[model samples]
Target: MKRLMLIGITVAALAGVAAAAPVSVEIATEPGLNVTAPQKWLQLFAEIGQTGVRIRGMRAGERPRLEELGGSRRVVGVLTRRGDLLLPGGKFRQRDRAALADYFDRVAKDGAEGVEAPRGRFDLTEKQFRTAYDALSEPLGFATKDQPPRAVVERVRDRLPIALEIDRAAERTLNNAGPLAEDLEPLTVGAALAVMLARDGLALTPEHPRGGEVRLRVAVAGDVADSWPVGYDPPASPRETAPVLFEFLSVEVEGFTLTEALDAITPRLGGLPVYWDHASIAEAGVDPASTQVRFERKRTYYKRLIDKLVFQARLKSRLRVDEAGTAFLWIGR
Candidate 1:
């Protein structure tokens, strides 16, 4: 098995590092894709993010799939170098337009595009896009691939340019702190250690409008460690700000999972309101599992009501219509 080969290398390294009767502890996870990683936080996370963490082993094939580790049931295709997990969640749809558009304009501009289509192949014209519907268009998928619109992603072993692909989930961690990664690395390391101790998952929530969040599962061993968020200003977009991720080795958190710290510090950690109607509208417009709507349109209609009043020899006709009758018709919109 590919996993066996990948493990062979790590095991060899561990053989030397940990010697006979290494301090190894195993835990049973309800989530699949169990990690038999190193006891060290750095080594453990490094391995999980490396090429060895594959569907079956290190290499990803056409039909290659994710080992569905935790959180929601996800069937990640193949991971790009930056740890971006492209879900088989299908494509984007009309309702998902805003999110997808933001993704293309923001994150996509920074990472690689896992799948390909000629420039503007989806529809170069907005008018055409409005009339075209595809499940691949949906911004994100929360549950099963059977969901109306799924993520249409390609299998890849390496990272794509930010312009082509960015881990959308990670986007949520972007924050006002400027450069997220710069400050995030230390925090990540600390969180890795704490989560390892707690036997929990690490979730990063956005601290501000400008930043995004990324969630990581614990896969190593270690106790409390020192960590801190050394701020760095990330590149600014016309509409948003960027938070640093990190490289600061000194800032440390004691005995806390990354999620716990993020929950304590991330500006938006609890919950945010999402419009279900938006997803429903997107689903109605696109479906990859069945017939996909390739054409979309938006329709608007107005009706005028006339009331005539006659006084003496004078007759007057007036039309009155309120905005209440006004409706936004997304039908083929």
Candidate 2:
């Protein structure tokens, strides 16, 4: 029903602009597949108008699914030889919207020359990779309610020292993942972003050209096998990085959910933040909210208790440090 309303709006908008605009855009979709909203379509065409294309006529129509159009579902704009652009059904972020306009403008003028294929590899020297990885250690905090991942990433990017780029396909994927709800404690910028992105099956991978600048690329997790980890090993010992976890504390839990155990131990960790591998847990079908766990120790430290709890839940805990040399707990399979 909502989709039908959207399609109606698209056709109406097309009719409203058709006589004035030279270029036409066809909004493509498959049954049960989603596409961009009418407002975004209008905004995209407005941006494209700035590109100075000769206006002719505008129209809206549906083609096959993106797969049938020889494009990935993650792709945004598909320009045809007839100067018509077909956009797959999906939401678009500001960056992606602008990217599409610029892309179409170029293709319309230059006949689709110099378009780069979807990037599959990121080459970086060991030092270059390390340099970018170190930036993840920078301390950061994130709190959002019903915000898209792309917007959250843009906020994070403004505060980070490292260069980060969201691939077009990845941007579409993130936007499609819908609004994110997160309230994370202070972790490194990398860890915070990693946790948020994990929920969408996305990841941040570092890249650098020889003698060039270092940057991090956000791509689908499966697409980039060597993406940055949720957390890295702490530079110092557990006692130094997170002394609270090592402090003596008697603990007992016959059957407590993962969240329950974390609640009891979080404050004791002495400001050590904890993050979960959202993608991994989802794929493994592990629901921390209801995953019952048991760990009893007459006399044990918080670290020991945490280990036992996660192990029972079929998860693991890692002591890692962010770029700021702050300690945090990364729990996942």
Candidate 3:
């Protein structure tokens, strides 16, 4: 009897602990507009809850604040005045309010907590806004595996008016570039397109803006192809005939911005120095100081770490060697 009572007590205690655990909530909203009515916000909360996000009412004497909403396992959605929807808990932001809400709702129903808020304004042109959204959302839980890039392209093409004329040659080139397996999250048109652009080296341009038509342009790096050729093959991968060695007594980095990260690691890279593109870094909104990286791989190839740093900063890296045998790590777009 005593043993049974102890078992019951332990189960009750575990249940209590589970019940006391904080719930995660993610809020989704349409494009930012001045919300003057508290009821509207409340209604939005109710609607979000109806989608099964398990939103709890604010406690007595508790106030709604963005910073306070962020928790270790919590995700909060908010809209900036620039009409951008952001997930505040170090997650990527997206502009498709419905899809974001659906995603958050799914997460919440899985016993997570999410919060949503509206924040300040920022100036962003249409193109800039689209570019930023595409860049950020590509890494988020927005692209699914098993979805072909060509299918995504077709979907995007269908959304645009029939007036848009897709270059068949460019389309073929992009298709032949192979499957994009970047992120296995959920699939969004924008995210898929970003992957395609990154992988296939193809560009999309709004050619007849007034007429609502877009044009596909094939402008792969180092190539000026007026028309994509059949059975065209990309250049062979560059192999380093000789490897360089670097000696580092020790290296430790924490919360360094891109510049600081570079400064700290470049010295350990032997004579190879990284050339940073300020404009690209600024455009990507990468603050090196905000990023943390640690490396203890002694005598390792510098190119490996340089690639990692650039990837963490949401930029690209290329290695260039001059005729003088000096190696340069080019970082940026």
Candidate that scores best on TM-score:
2
What's the CA error at residue 291 for candidate 2, in Å?
1.9
Ranking by TM-score: 2, 3, 1
lDDT of 3 by residue, 1-333 (tens): 957965764564344332222335554443334454223444554555533343332333433233333332454455444434345332333334466456444334322222232211122234433443343333223343455656656555545322223456655775675554434233333333433454455544322121111233334423432222111121333344124422224344456665677776666655554454444565677755576655544544455666666677678776543322334455666
In candidate 3, what residue range of length 10 has the lowest lDDT sum? 225-234
lDDT per residue as tens, model 2, 127-230: 55567767777666656557777777877777767656777888898778877545554767777777788888888988653223567789988888676666
Between candidates 2 and 3, the lDDT winner: 2
**Which TM-score value belongs to model 1?**
0.14
CA lDDT, every prediction?
A: 0.23, 0.63, 0.44
What stretches of model 2 exceed 4 Å from their correct place?
Answer: 1-122, 130-137, 141-148, 160-163, 178-182, 209-213
User: Residue 217 error for model 1, in Å?
Assistant: 31
What's model 2's TM-score? 0.56
Clashing pairs in 2: 21-56, 22-55, 22-56, 35-89, 35-90, 137-322, 137-323, 137-324
Write down the TM-score of every candidate.
0.14, 0.56, 0.26
Rank by lDDT, highest first. 2, 3, 1
lDDT of 3 at 265: 68
lDDT: which is higher, 1 or 3? Answer: 3
